[model samples]
Target: MHWESRHERAPAVTVLAVGAYTVDFYIFGDRLPSVGETVAATGTASAHGGKAANVAVAAARLGGRARFIGAVGGDQEGAEALATLTRDGVDVSACPRTDPPTARSFICLDSRGQQYIMTWAGAADGLTADVAAAGAALLRPGAVLVLQGEIPVAVSAAAAAAAVPGVTVVLNPSPVEPFTQPRSDPDAARLLARADLVVLNAAECRRLIGERAGSTPSGLSAEAAQLRRQIRTATVVVTVGAQGALVIREGSEMHVPAPEVKVVDTTGAGDGFVGALAAGIAAGMPLAEAVLLACRAAAVSVTRQFCIPSYPRASELSHAPLSPRQC
Candidate 1:
C-alpha cells in the first residue's frame, strides 16, 4: 500500500523498534576457529547489538526520531545498552529492566568481515505481549512500529495488533524461523496479515514461500510473486545483499539496486536497511523512494565494521550520489 496523507499533520514521525537488545562481543581473526580448537585473533571489540537495537540505532543515525521497546537485564550489559541507545538519541523510556541478565552475542569475524554469531537470550526472553503492547501505545497515527523476531513472536504480534491504522508496522523476522515455522497458534498466523511491510532475506523468503505455497518457488522472481500473494495486504521486500532488493507491492515490482561499495562487515546490514527504510517512511519519503534509500544505507553499512557503528548517517548518503535505479 502507498502512503496516503493523513487528514491532520503530526509533529514528527516516530519509529518505535520493538524487540531485543544485547552486548555484542566481536572477535576478529584471519579465519574462524575450527571445531574444538582455539585460534588467535587479529583483534576484538564489544558493542551494542541485537536486531532491534541495531535497527533503532541505525534509524537514529539516519536522522529519524526513534523509540526502543524491549527488555534488558539489571546488569552492566543492560546499562551499557541503554546508554548506547540513549547516546544515539533513541527513546528507551518504555523499555523495562528485568531480573534476568541482559542478552549477549558473541561474534567471530574473519578477515573478510563475514560473521558467525552465538547468543544468550537472558532478559530478552522476558519480553511479553503486555510489554510490547505498552510500547505500541506510545505510537500515534503517524508513527512506525518496527518489529523483529529476536524477541517472543507473541510480543511482536501484540505490537503489530496494537498499532493504529495510520501507523506503519514494519516486520523484520530475523533469525526468521520462529514466524515462518508451522504455527498452531492463530495469533502467529495474523502476524504477516498485520504487518504493513515485511523485509526478508533470500533464505527467509524461500522458507516462508515454501511453507505458504506448499512448494518451493522456482526462482527469485517466482518466490517474490508467491510471497506477495501470500501476504496480500502487506508490501513484500526481498533483499539480495550486494545485488540489491526486490520490492513487490500490489502486483507491481521494483528492483532497487544498491551502489557498489567495498565490503568490510556484512553484520547488521539487514538491520541497517530496515532502520533506514523506517526512517525514510517516518520522514515522509515515498515507499519506493524509501526502499531506494534503504538499499543505499545497507550498501554503505557493509563498507564498515561491526553493527550500529557501521550504519551510515543520512548526510553520508547524501554526500555520495547513489547509483542508478533498476525497476
Candidate 2:
C-alpha cells in the first residue's frame, strides 16, 4: 500500500530525536585512492547530516513534528546544522552548541554508489545525562522518543528512561559497539527495558550479539533470534540491505521485502527508514505496516545522492513508480 503523509496542521504525535549532529562532506570519485595515491574527486557537496539530524529532517519532511535534542560544535558547521534543521521544520531548541568544533563526516562515494564515511564525534560526544533529561521532559504519553548510538550510551539510556509509560521508545543502534557498561549498571538495564522497539541493521545485530556472546557467532537467523531473546523487553527489527528486514516480536518472526532500486549513495537510507518508521508508528500504524512504509522510503533514499536531500517527502512516495513489495 502506498501511504501518504496525512498529518493535520496540528500533528497528533511528536517525535523527539536524541543523538548526533554533523556537517557532511560528500566526495565523489572514480574509485578509492590507495595509500599515498591522489585521485581527484569527480564531484563534491556538503550537507547537514548526522543520524539524528537526518532522522529529524526526514520525520519533518514526512509531516511529523520533530524535535531534536543533541549537541553541535561552536563553529560554523554547528550554526549551519541548526539552520538546516530549522529550515526543515524541526524544533531545535533542545539542541545546544558546545565549546568543541561541531562533528564532521567525510563521505567518499565511488562510481558504484558505495560509500565510506569517516566521522569525528566532536561536540556530539558531549551529550550528558542532564541535557538528555531536559529533552525527555517533552515526552508525553503518545510521543515517540527516537534514540541512536552516535551519542554517549548513558545519554541514550537516560532518554529512554525519560519516556513515560505510554510513550514509545525506538532505539536504532547503528554504529553499535560492545557494551562497556558493567553488567550491574541499572542504567544500562533501563535502556534495554524501556525501548518498545529496537531497529538495527544486520551488522549491528551481529556485533551486538557478538559482544554479548564474547565471540562472533555464525548464521544470521540464529543470531537474530539470540538478539531478540537478549533484549527481551523490546521488539527487534533487523534490516538486511536490499533484501529488506526481519521483524521479531511477541514470540513470532517474519521477513519484509524491500523494493529493488538502483543505488546511488546510501548515506541516509537507514536513517530515513528509522525516521519514517517512527513517524508511521506515531501515526498509529501497526508495526508491520510501518515497516513496509519504512522499507519503501529507504528504497527511495538509496536511489538518490546526499543525506537529507535523498529522503522522500510524503507526496514523492505517493507518486513513486515502484510498486509496494509483497510483505
Candidate 3:
C-alpha cells in the first residue's frame, strides 16, 4: 500500500515538526576539551538548531512545505532563529511564544567530525502538550508530522493524537527514555503507537528493544518484531552509520547501504535523513525508495559541517528517486 497518490513529480506536501527550538553555539577545535580543561578552538559560530527545528529546516530545503511548531524566547536569539527558519522557507506562524532567553546547545566538534553537545533547556520547556495539539491540528491528508525526543513525551503524544487520520507520523526516539519496556512510559507508548514510521539509530533501536545475547543489535528480524509488538508501527527503520538504513516491516527486511563519501561532521546527519525521508514520503515515493533517498541525502550532509547548515537541498540530490531492489 502507498501513502499518497504518486505523480511523475508529486507536488509538495506539508511536513510539520513539533518539538524543541534552540540556538546552537559551536566551538570547533582539533580535539574535544578534556574534563574541566580548556582547549584552543579553531573557530566558533552560532546558528539555529534543535531536533525539530533542524528537521523542519531540512524538509523545507528539500522542497517540502515544512512548518515548525515549537516555542521560542522573546530574546534576540529566538528572533534570529525565527528569521533563519523563515529564510529557509519554513513556516513559523504556528510557533508559540514563551519567556526570553531561548533554549541553547553548546557543541564541541573535533577535527574527525565527532561532537559532544551540551544543552540548556530554556523557553523550550514552555511548549506544552496543548500547544503541540494545536499545531498538529494543522496537518491534513498526506501530510507528514515529525516528532523527536527533545520535547516532553506527553507533548509528542498530544501532537500524534491530534494528527489527522491521513497524516503520516514519523517518530525519532532520540535520547531514548525507558519508555519501551514492560512498564513503559505511557505517554511515550502512546506516541509510538501513533507513529506510522519510526526512525532511530542502531544504538537507539537496541535501547528501545532491550539487547539480547546473540542478537544482531540492529533492526534484524527478531529485534524488529520486538519493536513491532511494542508499538504497532507500519515500518521501523534502524539507521547504521555508513551501512545505510535497515528497513523492517511485516516479515521482510532490507538493508539500504549508503554511498561512501568524505566525512566532515556526523552531526545532524540523522536529522537530514529524517527530513529527506519525510520529503520523499510527501512527494509520494515508496518507503524503500524514500529510505534510499534519505540515505543519499544523509551522505551529502556528512560531507559538510554543522547542523542545519549541513542539510542538502532538493537540487543537490539530482535523480534522488532511484529504483529500489524488491524488499
Rank the candidate models, highest lDDT first: 3, 1, 2
Question: lDDT score, residue 86, model 3?
Answer: 96
Clashing pairs in 3: none
Model 3 / residue 196 / CA error / Å: 0.6
Candidate 2, superposed: residue stretches over 4 Å from native: 1-13, 33-40, 178-186, 211-218, 319-327
Please state the error at residue 115 of candidate 3 in Å. Answer: 1.5
Q: Write the per-residue lDDT of candidate 2 for residues 79-117, one digit (tens) a residue.
A: 888888998889998787899999989999998788788
The count of backbone overlaps in candidate 2 is 1
* lDDT string, candidate 3, 71-120, tens digits: 99998888888898999989899787887579998889999898998778
**How many angstroms is residue 38 displaced in model 3 relative to the true structure, after the best TM-score fit?**
5.7
Ranking by TM-score: 1, 3, 2
For residue 100, model 2's alpha carbon misses the true position, in angstroms, by 1.1
TM-score of every model versus the real structure: 0.90, 0.87, 0.89
Q: Which stretches of candidate 1 lie above 4 Å from their native place?
A: 4-8, 11-13, 33-40, 211-218, 319-327
Candidate 1 per-residue lDDT, tens place, 18-58, comes to: 99998889999988877898999898898778999988988
